[model samples]
Each structure stands twice: as structure tokens, then as C-alpha cells.
Target: MKRNIVILASAITALCSCNDGASDKAPVADSSEVKTAPENNKYTSQPLVTHIYTADPSAHVFNGRIYIYPSHDTATGTPENDNGDHFNMMDYHILSMDSVGGKITDHGVALNIKDIPWAGRQLWAPDAAFANDTYYLYFPVKDKKDVFHIGVATSKTPEGPFTAEKEPIKGSYSIDPCVFKDDNGSFYMYFGGIWGGQLQKWNNNKYDSAGKLHQPDELAVLPRVAKLSADMKSFAEPVKEIKILDSTGHLYKEKNNDQRFFEAAWMHKYNGKYYFSYSTGDTHNIVYAIGDSPYGPFTYKGLLLAPVEGWTNHHSIIEKDGKWYLFYHDVQLSGKTHLRNVKVAPLVYNADGSIQTVHSQK
Candidate 1:
């Protein structure tokens, strides 16, 4: 049976403050000083749709329309909520926006778990890109033990029943897959997560997984990058692990606290500068760094957004319209489980090109 599930974003004013240290002042910018742009180009707090339960949102302007591909969680499956519990959700769903102010029409599951042989019922973190009349969905899947690995699938239509490649894109355990097509038309895949293996300890390359000294393990939780072949079917070269952020020292020193390093990497090229935003501190907040190139010597740009106490902010970034809009997920107040509902707000930038702050709607 063909089903069209149109999930909508509802209006809820759950105010969450952006942390700027001990300041009690609100994070809102003065609207009087803010210059307005054209009606079609202006930023607003209104969401086109609501009531969604997807996370790790990756959007693109394709064929005069906006299409969003996110990790698909089966509404009727086990671990039916989004509280980090691993279950079989090996599908990519698509939402299409016809116009700037148009409603988001959920086109049902674009891909499904039955499509991938090695996938063990769980899917998470998906990103999509269009090339050569095909839309590519890059996502992560887990085996029975919940060990994750990255995979790719392709379809001719934006709203698709994508077909997974016969094999994974060449890596062991990993998740949160992101695909970047460079200006020169080169394709690259960035992904990593808590893969079980003897990899290097977080933050530094000193210790191994077993607390022994050795070279970095290819199956570490830390982020890694690899180039794809021209056809995007296989890895063109070897997987090169890149340490996004490590908290080995912090984790070792503060043994009582659960230390999280970097995961969930999304790369965007803006104004000749490459911005890499990633999740940190238990996927509760986001931090970013910029570099001159995609493969880089990156410099930390500080925190872009933080957790809202009652909510978590995972993989997100600004959608560059006339005014930038930050797209992220938050746990709705009404739900007990963390079903990562999508939310957006204006992203203001400082004179130095760093994100000044992201404001939430009241």
C-alpha cells in the first residue's frame, strides 16, 4: 500500500536560553536595529510544518524545491521513541517544500531497512545530495550488537524508494553520515560514532582502546573522512580518520562525568570558508570550527548552540538564505521520549564571521 504521511511542525513556545555564561539577560536581538529584507527573503520564526520525530536533518534546495532527508524511526517499532535506543530504522524519509512559504509534504519513507542486507533494524543520521539525475542518501546502520556502520543509497526521484548499494562504503563501525560535493564536483563522506574496537583514545592519539599505546584504530568513536569514487559507488581511496574533538584528557581527569568528544559532522562551504559543525557533550550542544579547505587544519570557532536543559541539540547548521536560519531538533515538552522534533530560528553572525548566537522563538 502506498502511504503519504504528512507530519507537521506544531506551534509550541518552549523557551530555551542560549548559554552566555552567568548572564540573566535574554538572548533576543533588538528587532528595531535589525534590518528587514524582502518578504520572500526575510527570516521568520514560523515553521512550514510540524509534529515531526526525525533528527539529524540535512536539507537541500533541489530542482527549485526544498527537500529534507532525515533518519527514519519507525512509528510502530520497538524503542518507538528517539531516546538514543538502537532499533531497526533503516530507512530515509523525504519531505518536500514546493515554495518558500509552502507547507512541507511528507512523502512517506524514501528508503527502508528491508533494502539493506547488513543493516540490523536501526538507522540513524542521514544526509542527501543530488548528482547526475540521482539523489544520494548517506546514512548509518547498526548490526545486531548495535555497532554502527555508514552506507549509501540512491534513487531517481527526490521522494524515493532508494536502493542501497550491495555493500557499505568501505569502513568498519561508524554512523552519522554526511556527504559533501565540492565545487570541483568531488564527493566526500564524513562520519563516525562509538564503534566497538581497539581505536585510539579520544582527544589524543596516545592511548589505544585497551589503554595500550599504539596507532589509532580505524574503528574509534572519533570522526573520520574519506573520498568517494566518481560514481559514488565505492571509496576511491583509503579512509582517513580525522579527530574532530577529543576529550581523552578531560575524560581521564573528570572520571566521574561522562565526557563526549566530537561526532555528527556536517560541512558547508560559505564564502570560500569551510565550516564544520559537530555534536559534543553527549549530543546536547553543538560546536563548530572553520578551515580554508574541506580537508583541513581547522581552528575551533567555539559553541554555536547549547542544550536547553530539558532538551538536546544534535546535528544542525544555518540554512543560508538572505538571512541564515539554524535548523535543529528538540524534545517536545508534551512527549516523554526524545522524538527529536525540528525547530528553526534566526542565526545571527558577529563581525568576525563567527555565530554570535541563535535565538529561539518565544
Candidate 2:
């Protein structure tokens, strides 16, 4: 297994190495129904770990273990709120477990914000995957200009002290970078956000490729799609604009635009159907659309996971050992939106190939 990794980090000796460990076509037994030791809360199992808050969970199953790469939510600075005062994140920690209800191990901080030459302080939702034996971590952070740029890091192991490339992926600017490696071995990248094209340009402003400033309306930032070259750092083709639904779906449109997909674009292939799932920002429901190809003429499906208590809902769906799990975060512990904790629950599919809406406990 180690033979396929690209060990680029100089501190190979310091990499967080430890024992490590979703989703479904068939009926999966409710994890809450598993009947573990009774607890005061509705959830039967605890948040994978509580050492610190983590959000925007991206789970990947590699070598039969479910590895989670989540943004490290912090309370060190001002509290996080809806007005974007603080969503202070600086690094990512890799968490993994052998199975459900098992010991969740901390693989340590895999990457840090300070290491990236172009990165600003905020390190938001990120993702990890294994392709061609090398594990790649895709992360997003605002540069000095406060523009969100998606970047990549490589490691020989899933849990690592990864070395990041000096520059963000060219022609790529957005948050919540999620990459899906299809069954046929092709790779695709998805990213974007709202508020005048991803975080309101950090100041309700807009800028062109030359960093020239303008009003938000001058730029339109929707979820984006691109094919990744074999190296995983550059685009194989020009990044394309994508829409979750089209005229095929019965929905009203003003000049054919729909904001159903707010952000957190996650993709997975199940039973030959491409399930394009994402979080609807303003409304706060994790919804999905179905597509026949990686690039889609998609048909919209309803909620996979409904709105939770938190203001923001970011999620990832995966199938493990014939069962599906939807990983998301909520402000259950801190009672504050920014200090969110990651949680996982079983995700099921309906007969029509749509995902079931999950009802979670507080």
C-alpha cells in the first residue's frame, strides 16, 4: 500500500501515522438502532472525536478504512456568526476508525495554513482521496487578496504532514474543494460558494483575473467543474459551469438560473448513476441531483439530509461495506454556528435512486 504514495514531505518521520479505519444501495440498519450503551442524547455514538471542533467533513475509504479530513474549527479568536465575523480555521486534522463505534484515532494535523505561500488565515472545508497510489488533499484558503483559491497537497499516506504546492491551481478560484475519482479512473474537481460568487469576495466585492476590484454583480460564482490531469495539480480541460437542474425538471426559472446548489459540491457514483450532491446555502438543506455522466445533464432530486440546527450545512456521502453514511457538522456542543462538530449518520437510497432525508437529533 505504501508503495503507491508520493512522499513529498521532508519530515517523513513526523507524519501522523496511526491505526485508521459510508453509503448504500441496499437497506442499511439505522446506526441509532444498533443499541449501543444508552446515552442522554438522541445519537447513539459520539462525534468521532471531541479534542477540537471540526466541520465540512469529507470522508474517504482507503485500504478498508474510513478517513475523514475536516476543517479545524476554532474558538481562539472572535466567535463565528452568520455575518462572517469569524469562521477561523487554520489547519486540517485527519481522523479515522476501523469501524462504526470503534476508537477514532487522530492522525494529527495533516496540513497547516501558514505553510502555503499564497494562503490567508482561513482554511475551510477540504477533501482527500487516493489515486494512482498517491493520496491528495484538496483545500481552499483566501490568498493575500482575500480571494478563495483551491489548492492541492500530496502525501504517500492518507494521514500525513503533507507538503503543499506553492501556487493555487491556476484558473481555479472558489471554496470547498471536493474531488471525485470515478470508477473508470478518471478524476474531476468541484468547487464554489454564494454571496456574489463565493464568500462575497470577502468584502461584498468582485475581482477579475488581474485582481482588479469591482462590485459583486460583475462576477457570478456558482459551483464549478473541471477534469484533473494525471498529475492532479493542473486542469485537463477548461473548467466548465454546471447547473444542477434544467428545463427537464419542473421548476420556474428567471432566465434559466437556479440556486438550488449553494455550495459543498460532492460527487459519488452508485450503480452506474452519478449522484451529484450538495448543500443549498440560504435554505440549508443537503440536496442532490442525478446525472448519467460525470459531467451531467442532471435531474434534480430532493433532500438527502434536511436542515440541521446550524446555519451552514456542508456534507459528504460515501458507501462503506455495503452501507452508506452521510457525514456533516452541526453546532450541537458549542451552541454557536462557527464552532461546529462533525457527525455521521447512515444515508439510504430510495427505490427511484434518490437519497433519503436524515432526521438527526440535537
Candidate 3:
């Protein structure tokens, strides 16, 4: 649900502040100045989507174009609601970058809270993957009981009037649903947060409904995985506490914050190696480690992206044509930590197989 303190603090604040157990509704931006990024080869500092607040960027390439699924940020509409300072998102918008550089088109709301039968008000970060000739959107939302469950929405096309499944993917209770397909054509579901993370790989090319599940705040979690069934509505083959390494080459969690993954788990397979990248939970920085396999005893690498002022530093890495780009968000639009704007920068690799520190500003 967040990057750094303001968002994490806001989420923790929202989680703690909500007497009724929900994210606080945010206050609307008042004449916020939007920075127009300079057109240059160095970097594109400005947000790809402006005019409205967006957060939790989930970038995907479809039909030779880059399609981004971002959570909508809006005002709470009431002065008393967390002073209008919160994560208050209820829907998602599908924005597609028509070209590699500039020009982002708002395809409007792809899915709404009202359409989701089992979802609560705070619709958080969402991710989408294309498979079986269908676009499946993975979403996490707080239930009425204030517990978050991962759900999948389906659409015939990229910009969709998506139909959400009445039931969420069972056997897991975490946020930020990221789905990836390996070279072998098998699907893997990666999820979990804060206290730990999880990873699960698909078997026989389908999801199993009877796997184990855990809460987002579970202290024992560590990159567990589950099979994303072909139907995309269930999961199975739960692996528990797959070890992630700290800087000292020991199990993660044993150490403190330095080079430790706080939350926001993203997986990328490059050069026949698995790159497990995540946000450092103080919400200020992003770091990654590499392992020989997807669920691995990964060696702690280095920081991927430096901290942005606002809060969350969630990012996605994708390749287009022959170049790689990083999709992340910043609080530049409204200057308030929670009201974030999505930004993109060219991401490149070093000869040593490690990622370079992101210079997102021009």
C-alpha cells in the first residue's frame, strides 16, 4: 500500500488511525503544480500521467505498447476523514504510453470498487498479466473486516470493462499482487509484505486451491510462492519462508534495515538469473538481490533506486524493443506525501550483472 513513512506512516497511520479499520480518505489537491519533464536523452523527470493523482505503478507491455495500471488517488470528500490525509483509493485507471518517450493516454477507470462484490473502499496497488489470450488484473483490497485479500479481475483487452471475480484468490492474504510468467510458460504468483514476503511457482500450468495462506503482517513470511491456476482465480503449491539474504550473507530479517527488504516484492529474470527487487520499508529506497533460482538463497546486491521525498518507492522493470525502463511514482504533483504521480526513467544494466542506481531526475 505505500513507499516510505508518509505513505507507510500514512498506511500505518491509516491502519492505526481508522477506528473502523480502513484507509483514511485523502484531501483533494488544491492547485498543485505539475512539473513538465524536459524532453531529453538523460531522463524524463516529470510524471507520465498528471491532472489526477496516481500511485502504485504496475507497468506491463501489451500489443507493442506500454500499459500501466495505477491506483487512483482521490480526496476523502469530508474534512474529518483523516484530515483528508490518507491513501484513499477506490478504483484503478489504465494509462498507456503511446510511444517510448512522452504521450500518456488515460483510458479511464478500468475497474471500480462498486463493481467488486467482496472489496472494501480502499483499493490499493494492482498488477496485470496477459495469458491464455486474456488480460488478468491482480488487485489487493481491504475487506470489510479490514483484512486485505488478493483478487483477480479479467478483461478481454488491455483497456477493459473488466469483470472482477466474485471470490478472491484463496490460500493467501497479502497485498500488492504481482504475477510473472517464466520462459517455460509456467505462471508464478509473488506476494507478501512488511514482516516478510512469499513466492510460489506453478505446477502442471495451473493453480491449486488448497495451499496455505498468511496475513500481510505475518512476522515469519519470506518470499513464498503459489501456483497461479490457469483460471486465474485460485492458487496452490505454497512454499514457506524461502530464504532471502542480508548484506552479511545470512538470512534476511535477522539483520536491521541496511540492505533489507521491507516490502514491495518485484521479480525479474535476466541473463538466466533471478533478480528479486523490493522497496526498503523506511519507504525511502529500493534495493535488490540476485539468486540462481526464482525462490532462492539470493545474495544481497545493491540499491536499485534512491529515495524520493514523498513516501513509497515501488517500482517495475520492463523491456521494450531493446531497452529497459523503470516505472515508479513520486509525490511531486501535490507535494503531499500520499498524493503521488507516476514517473518513468530509462533503466540500464552494468557489465557486472548488477543494476545501476536510478537517476530519475533530469
Candidate 4:
């Protein structure tokens, strides 16, 4: 999927002020820091195995294996004009590793447009969740007109052919579809970005065409949430749109309108508090908020990290072996296009229940 690249400059300026109270401390290198290997041998290790081109990655530890679902973009820059005539084949791909510290292996495509009935071609950001012995994958796809819609698919294994339900979770021009299962055994899907639109619900527990549901006016904006049915195939309630960071927040000033502050929403509960992390000031920087519940009245926490070499940061938080880590994408050598390369970083929280900082991988 194409990101709004114009916001890169504004993101840099906004991120400069986000470090208000951050200490000047540097990241601590791992004691067993492995020496940098030759380019050909990079993929032979844990760190380099993750250095592949995978954007908007969602990770989970299933049966002692770490599975990563990401939007697959062509490594070859041969641009195929997708101007309504062709389908964007960039499907949701899966990569897995035997353990958290093991080398990741590419498992191939899990779901693609061809798998979905009447699904448009282009597939973008995807998020996955496990429920009732099944893996549910939520992702966005574009139709002939290039209009985006969110869809869901299921698979028995984390790395396998995911069966696309006949319908999408909700039909609308939406992207970054993320699924979050609550402690109460409830399911919720969150999505929305540049359009400044809100979230929607699948009240009927079924998928329909984009034109079937209400217009964008009926939906909520950034960081929206909706409750899903027990079966995880349909919605049990109206989509509840939540604005974790509103115009009143420090990052959303009128002056920063060019920045397009709200996008890339990812939520996870830890220590009895709900944390919502999102991209701000372009993909170059990230910010977060805290809420009491999934359908929350979230308050802005502040900027988590600034742009490093103009590389935008889109992140996901997962707890593995009792520790929390932030999985995000960054630019390799700089330049534009923001074709994400997966990276792992350690996330720290403050005593008062706020995010302290998200550091880069060592």
C-alpha cells in the first residue's frame, strides 16, 4: 500500500519537541552482541533473519513459534501501473521461527485477493489473532476503483492457507486492520489512517460490500474499536470509534495539519492498563496513549521515538516469555518509499503507567 509520503518533513519537526522529558541516556548493548557478519551471511543469525522487507508486521507466539504476518511488496522495483486496470497482488505473507531467538523462515502467502470472493486486488496492512484453535487474519484490500476495504480470513495453523470468509468484517475504505482479543474473551478490530475517518462495527457478524454499510460519516476516527462475536466471524455490537489523540492533544495542533498525526493503530493490554500506540507526524515517528478499557477514553502519553534517518516507525507490541517488545519497520539506508524492513526493539514503561521509550534493536 502507498503511504502519504508528504508528511515526512513535518514528522521530523514534530518529533523534535516530543522528547521534552526524555533523559539523554543511550541504549545499552546486549552483553552477547554478535559481530556484524558479511552481507551474504547476515540471514544466518537471529537479528539478520528479521532484516527482510516486510511492512506492517503483526507477530504472535503460537505453539512455541514466533509467526509474523506482513504485507508482501515486490523486492524488484518494477512498477506495475495499478490505475484501476490491474490488481495489486501484494498479499499477506507469513514468516515463522521455532523460537523467539531462532532464525526466521519464510512460510509464504497465507492469504491473497484470489482467495477472497470478489475481493479487489491490492492487499495492504494485516493483523492476526488466535481464538478457539483458529488463527484469524484481518487485512485491507482495494477494489477496481482503488477503494480499500477490510477483510478477515482464518487458518488452523499460523503458517498456512487462510480461508477468506465470504464477506469482509466491515465494508469501507479502511486500512491497517488490527484484531485485539480482550480478557473477557471478546474480540475487537481497529483500523483507520490518512482519511481522518473513524472505526466501524460489524453489527450483523458478517461481511458485506463497501457500499452496503454506512458512509464514512457514520464511522469513528483514529484508534477506533468494535466488539466481535464469540465465534470471531461476526460483530456483536456497533463499531465503537475511539480517538486516543484528538485535536486538543499536543501532537494535533492546526499548525501540524500537514503532518497528518493519526495513523497505524495497535493496542494491547498489560498491567491492567490498555496501551494504544500509533504513528504520528508521518511514519518517521511514533506516539501512544493509555486507556482504561478497549473501548476507551484514552489520554495521550507522548512521543515514543523520533525519526531516525527519515525512517518512519509503524509498531506492534507483544509479550514473549514475560517480556514486552515493540515490533516495527524502519528504512534500511534512507531515501524515500518507506518500504519497511522489520526490526525488534525493547519497550519500557514509566512507573505512573506511561511509555518511557522504544529503543532500536541492538
TM-scores for every predicted model: 0.72, 0.80, 0.79, 0.72
Per-candidate clashes come to 12, 15, 18, 9
Question: Could you tell me which 10 consecutive residues in candidate 1 have the lowest summed lDDT?
Answer: 1-10
Tens digit per residue, CA lDDT, model 4, 216-255: 3333223456777778777677655575555465323323
How would you encode candidate 3's per-residue C-alpha lDDT over 1-362 as one tens digit per residue? 12322332222222212111111222223333334333332223556655567777888889998898887877655233321226667888787864445356777779999899998757878888988899999887767765567888999999786899997777766567677788887777777555212122222323333433333343323655676777767775653445677667666442345565556778888999988887765546788889887667788888888887576778888888887878788776566666787776666688989886764443
Return the lDDT, model 3, position 291.
86
**Order of all candidates by lDDT, from best down to worst?**
2, 3, 4, 1
lDDT of 1 by residue, 5-38 (tens): 1111111121111110111222222211222111
Candidate with top lDDT is: 2
Question: What stretches of model 3 exceed 4 Å from their correct place?
Answer: 1-44, 77-85, 195-221
Q: Evaluate residue 104 in candidate 1 and report its C-alpha lDDT on the 0 to 100 scale.
A: 61
CA lDDT, every prediction?
Answer: 0.55, 0.70, 0.67, 0.57
Q: Give the distance in Å from residue 126's predicted Cα in candidate 1 to where it truly belongs.
A: 0.7
